[model samples]
Target: MGWLLLLAAGCSEIVFAVSLKFNDGFTKLWPSVVTGISGIGSFYLLMLAIRTLPLGTAYAVWTGMGAVGVAVIGVVWFKEPADWVRLASIMFIVVGIVGLKLTHAE
Candidate 1:
């Protein structure tokens, strides 16, 4: 349950990040609304997750998920660089997230 909450939080974080780009520095209307909603949703879900999960582990996984997700979105949706180095770095973040999940007890 905690992991599921964290995953939802991460996805919300990804949406929050991507919406920031479209928000035009909060000058836009709909995008800004989306950003605000998703940002709050992410934090709320993460808070719920941390109730049962280790705080350090939950925070690290949350951030790692956001970073990797945004990077992938940048590459695919924005047509940003897909160079080997960038891809490898994203993979490393993923590995770390997975490692934290697997190693976590209770």
Candidate 2:
């Protein structure tokens, strides 16, 4: 269940991050509002995940996952530059997240 909570937190982080692209610098009303709510919710879930997971490991995985997810979204959905170097960096973030999850002490 702790892992599930952590995953949920990571998802929320991704949502908040991707929504930022649509927020128009917080000018677009609906997307900005959604982004604000999601950002708060992400932080809330992250705090909950920390209750059962080691703070260092959980935070590293959460942020890494969020970064990777947002980078992918930026590339695929927003047509942002996703050159080989950027893709490789995102892959490293995924690897780090996986490694932390596997090695994290319960």
Candidate 3:
């Protein structure tokens, strides 16, 4: 359940991040609204996840996965280049997340 909440937080983070591209520095209307709402939801879910999980573990997973997801979104949706180092770093983040989970006391 806590993991699910954490994933939800990460998803919200991705949404807000991608929306930032469309938000046009908060000049746009709809994208800015979406960004605001998703950002709030992301932090709320992050708080909930930390209720059951270690703060450091939950925060690392949330930010790490959010970063990886947004990078993928940038490549696939925005046609950004997927460099080798970027991909490798994403893999490292995945491994780190797994290690945190495995070593988590709860």
Candidate 4:
């Protein structure tokens, strides 16, 4: 359950991050609203997640998810660079996320 909440939080974090790009420094209307909502939602979910999960592990995984998710979105949706080095770095973060999850005990 905590892991599930963490996952949702991670997804919200991604949305919050992506929305920042469209918010135009909080000048935009809809995008800025989305940014505010998702950012708060992500933090709330993370708080709920930390209630049951280890704080350090949950925080690390949550941040790792946000980083990897935004990087992928940048490459695919924004047509940003998809160079091998960047891809490999993303993979490493993914590996670390997986490692943390696998090692965690309920």
Prediction-by-prediction clash tally: 0, 0, 0, 0
Judging by lDDT, tell me the better candidate of 2 and 3: 3
lDDT of 3 by residue, 1-106 (tens): 8999999999999999999989999999999999999999999999999999989999999998899899898989988888999889889998998898899886
Q: Per-residue CA lDDT of candidate 4, range 5-94, in tens? A: 999999999999999999999999999999999999999999999999999999999999999999999999999999999999999999
In TM-score terms, candidate 4 sits at: 0.99
Task: Please give, for residues 11-85, the per-residue lDDT of candidate 1 as tens digits.
Answer: 999999999999999999999999999999999999999999999999999999999999999999999999999
| Superior by TM-score: candidate 1 or candidate 3 | 1
- After superposing candidate 3 on the true structure, give the runs of residues whose Cα lies further than 4 Å from its correct spot: none
Q: Give residue 102's error in model 1 in angstroms.
A: 0.6
- The top-ranked prediction according to lDDT is 4
Q: By summed lDDT, which 10 consecutive residues of candidate 4 come out lowest? A: 97-106
Each model's RMSD to truth, in Å? Answer: 0.6, 1.2, 1.0, 0.4
Q: For this target, which candidate reaches the highest TM-score against the unseen true structure?
A: 4
Tens digits of per-residue lDDT for model 2, 80-106: 997899999998898888999889776
Instruction: Give the per-residue Cα lDDT of candidate 3 at 14.
Output: 96
lDDT scores in order: 0.98, 0.88, 0.94, 0.99
